[model samples]
Target: ASSSSPKMVKAIRVHELGGPEVLKWEDVDIGEPNEGQIRVRNKAIGLNFIDVYFRKGVYKASSFPFTPGMEAVGVVTAVGPGLTGRQVGDLVAYAGQPMGSYAEEQILPANKVVPVPSSVDPVVAASVLLKGMTAQFLLRRCFKVEPGHTILVHAAAGGVGSLLCQWANVLGATVIGTVSTKEKAAQAKEDGCHHVILYTEEDFVARVNELTSGNGVEVVYDSVGKDTFQGSLECLKLRGYMVSFGQSSGTPDPVPLSALAPKSLFLTRPTLMQYVVTRDELLEAAGEVFANIASGVLKVRVNHTYPLSEAAQAHADIESRKTSGSVVLVP
Candidate 1:
C-alpha cells in the first residue's frame, strides 16, 4: 500500500494484559500521518523488558488494544504538514512513549525520531536505541563513572546490562557484573566486565565486598529488581547510588527511607522518557549512542531476531531470560 493510502498492516496488539498468549497478531489500520508526524516503514524493532512489564500489567496501559513497543528503526515513508527536518526516505530510529512500534509501519512524532547514521545498521540502531541510551544517561548523567570508580551491574549479559558494562569500562571505571550462569559470566567478561560474579553460584554482595576488599562499589545498576534490590544496596559503598531501571524478575518492594539510612545511599528509578523530554535531548543522547557504535567503542550484539509476527515468542524469550544481548523484531 502507498504511504498516503489508508490500509491495514500486520501488528501485534494486546486486547488484554496477560502472558505472551495475550499478544495477538492481527491486521491494524494505518492512515496518513497527521501534523507533526511521519510514517515509518519499520525495518527493525527492539524488544525490551519494559515491553513485558506492559504485557503483564505491571505497567498500566493508557487504553485497551494497545501496541506495545518503544524502539524501532525504519525509513520515513511519509511526512505530514508542520514537520521539519524529517523527510521521506530518511533512515531514523526512535525510542520513547506512545508505545506502537511492534508493526511493519508506524506513525512517530517528528520530534521523537532521530536520524540513524548511515554507517550503522538499522537492526543495530533498533536494538540499542533504548538500551544504549539508558546506559548513556546512567553512566554519564545519573553518576559520572570515572577512572578508579568501581560499579556493579546486575544481569550483565542483558541488553541494557551489557551496554552498561561496556560503556562503564570505556569510561575507565572498574565494572563488576553479576550474571546468573557461568556462560553469561563469560560473555559479560568479554563485554568489558572487569569482574564477573555468577550470582547463581555465589552471593553477589559477598563477592562484591571481597573483590573490593571490604569496600563496595561507587554505583550499583540493578535491573533485576525484586531479587537483587536489597543485595544491590549491600554491594554499594557508603553514599553510593543505586540505579534501578527495570524489573525483569519482578517489581521491587516498597523501599522505606530508613533503608537508605544505614549507608546514606541514593536510590533513583529513572526512565528514558524523562531524560529525553526535549527534542534536543533526544538527539543528543541518540547521537552519542550512534557515534559510539560507529566508532567501534560500543558493540551492539543483536544475538536474537524474530519476525514481527513472532513478537510473542520474542517477549517470552526475554521474560524467561533465555536470550542475551539485544533482541530485535524484523519487519
Candidate 2:
C-alpha cells in the first residue's frame, strides 16, 4: 500500500491546544516504522469527546503538536520487525491509545491492533472499536449488568451511551438514561433505553427515584462528571455502583468518601485501557464486541461523518452537542 501511494498526506494535527481551531488540516509526511510497528493507511477516524478534552488542554498528557484520534480503520502498508501475523495489506482497526489518529497513515504497535472481519465494513470497524470496547468493559467487565438489574446512564445519546443502552438491553437490564433534550431522549429510547430523562427540563434525581418507584437503580454510569455527579449519587440504590467514566461536562469536584455512607454505594471510574491491558484481554474484549456486532444485538451508530479537513467542524458539532449518537471522520 505504501508503494502504491505518494509522499505527503493531509493530516489533522494540533499546533496548539485551545479549541477545534487548533486541529489544522495540513500536509504531513507519513514516516516509515522503526520496529514493532506498522503504518496504517487510515480510511476512517472516530471522533470522541476525549479528543475535545485533549484539544481544550484539560487532559494535558500531550505535547504541543499531535494527531488526536484514538481509533481508526485502515490497511496495513508497512510491517516492522518480529511481527509476522499482521502483514502488509491486512485490514485492521484499534482504539485504547491516543495522539496518533486524524491522519492518512498512523504507525502503531503491532499488538495494539485487531484484524478486521471481512463481514464488517471499514467505517463500522472504526466506529465501534473504541466505543464498543468501552461498552464491553463497562457492562461486561466493570460491574457486569445482569438481567433484572436496573442502571442509570448519563449522556444516553452519546457514543458509548448508545452502545451501553443496546448492550445492557440485551443483557436484560432495565436501562434508564438521562439526556439534555427531547430529541436525545427519543434517540435513547430508540437505542433501547427503557426510560429517558430530559435533564434540562427534568429533575433527574427526582425522576430516577420516581422511575424506579423510589428504589433508584442498581448502577449509575455517570460520564457527564461534575454536573451530574451528585444527582448520580443520589439516584443509586443501596450498594449501587457509580461509574464515573468521563468528564464530558468538565471534571467533577472532590467528593467525600463518606458520601457513600447513606446508601453504601460503590464508586468506580474504569477506563478501557485498564480492562484491556494485555493482548489476550484486548482480543477477548474486542471479540465480545465483534461477536455482538456480527450477531446484530449491538448497533453502532455512525450518526455523522466528516471529511478529514472538516475535523474542526466535527469538533464544533460534538462540543455543541449538535450531533447525537456517534460521529466519524472519513479520510
Candidate 3:
C-alpha cells in the first residue's frame, strides 16, 4: 500500500478573509506523510489571536481556502518512510509554522513535533504549548526579567499574558497586570500578579506610575497595540523595553524615533517562530514549559473551549475580549 494517496478530513477552512464567519468547517483532503513528515490525528487544537489575524488578512495567507491553525496536541498515526525518533501511536505536540492544525489530521515535518508527557492532558498541552513558548521567549529571552524588576503586562488575563505573569513572578520580578474588569484582575492576582489595574476604570499609566512609586516599570509587555502602545511607553522607566507583541485593538500608527528619546526606551516585536527556529530551541522552550507545568509552577487556566467546528465562535469571543486564560478546540 502506497502512502501517497490523499485522505479526506474535516477542517476549518477560509476561502476568503473578512471576519469570524469566514471560518467554514468542511471536508479537506490530506495526503499521507511525505519524506521527513508524519501524519497526526489531532486530539486537541489551540486557538490563538494570530489565527484571527490570518482569518482577517492582517497577516497574509499563503493562499485562499487555507486551513488556519498553529498549535495542537495529537497522536502520530503514520510516520514517513526512513524517519527515526517517531512512530505511529506516539503522543506529540507542535506549534508555530506549517500552520495546518485546525484539521482532524495534518501532515507535519518530523522534527517539528515534540513528545508530550503522559502526565499532561492533551487539552492542557494544546491550550498552553504556543502561549507558554511565547511567554518563555518574552520573559526569559526578550527582556530577561529579573528580581526587583517591575514589569507591566497588558491583557494580563489572556493566554500568553497569564503565562507571562506566572513565569515573571517565578523569576522574582514584580508583576503588574492590566485587565478590563475586577474578575480578570482577581484572576491575574491569583496567577502571581503583584498588582492588577482595571484599565477600563482608571488611567493605567497613572496607576502604573503610582504602583511603581513613579519609578515606572522596567519593561511593558503590550499586546493591545493601538490602544496601549503610547501609554506603555509612559509606563516605562529610563531605557525600558517596550515589547509590542500583538494588536487586538488594531495596528498602531507609526512612531518616530523621538517617541523613545524621552525615556530612551527599547522596542521589540517578536514572534514565537523566530524564537524556536531550531529544533533544539523548540525542545528547550517546550521542555521548560512542560517542566513548569509538571512541577505546578505554571498553572494554565483552560477557561474556554469550543468544538473545532465552532472556531468562528471562539474567534468572536477572543476578539471581543470575552475569554480569559487559554482557549482550545477539540477535533
Pick the TM-score winner. Answer: 3
Itemize residue pairs with steric clashes in candidate 3: none
Put down candidate 3 lDDT per residue, 129-219, tens digits, no spaces.
9999999999999889999899999999999999999999999999999999899999999999999999999899999999988999999
Each model's total of backbone clashes: 0, 0, 0
Query: 1 or 2, which is superior by TM-score?
Result: 1
Q: For model 2, what is the error of residue 270's alpha carbon versus the real structure, in angstroms, after optimal superposition?
A: 1.3
Ordering by TM-score: 3, 1, 2
User: What number of backbone clashes does candidate 3 have, counting pairs of residues 3 or more apart or in separate chains?
Assistant: 0
Poorly placed runs, candidate 3 (over 4 Å)? 1-3
- Lowest summed lDDT window (length 10), candidate 2: 1-10
- Per-residue lDDT of 10-93 in model 2, one digit per residue for the tens? 888888878788889888876676577888999898888888988888877447678788889999988876668888999999
Candidate 1 — which pairs collide?
Answer: none
Relative to the true structure, how large is the alpha-carbon lDDT of every model?
Answer: 0.91, 0.88, 0.93
Q: How accurate is candidate 3 locally (lDDT)?
A: 0.93
Which candidate has the top score in lDDT? Answer: 3
**Candidate 2 Cα errors over 4 Å, as ranges:** 1-7
The TM-score measured for candidate 1 stands at: 0.97
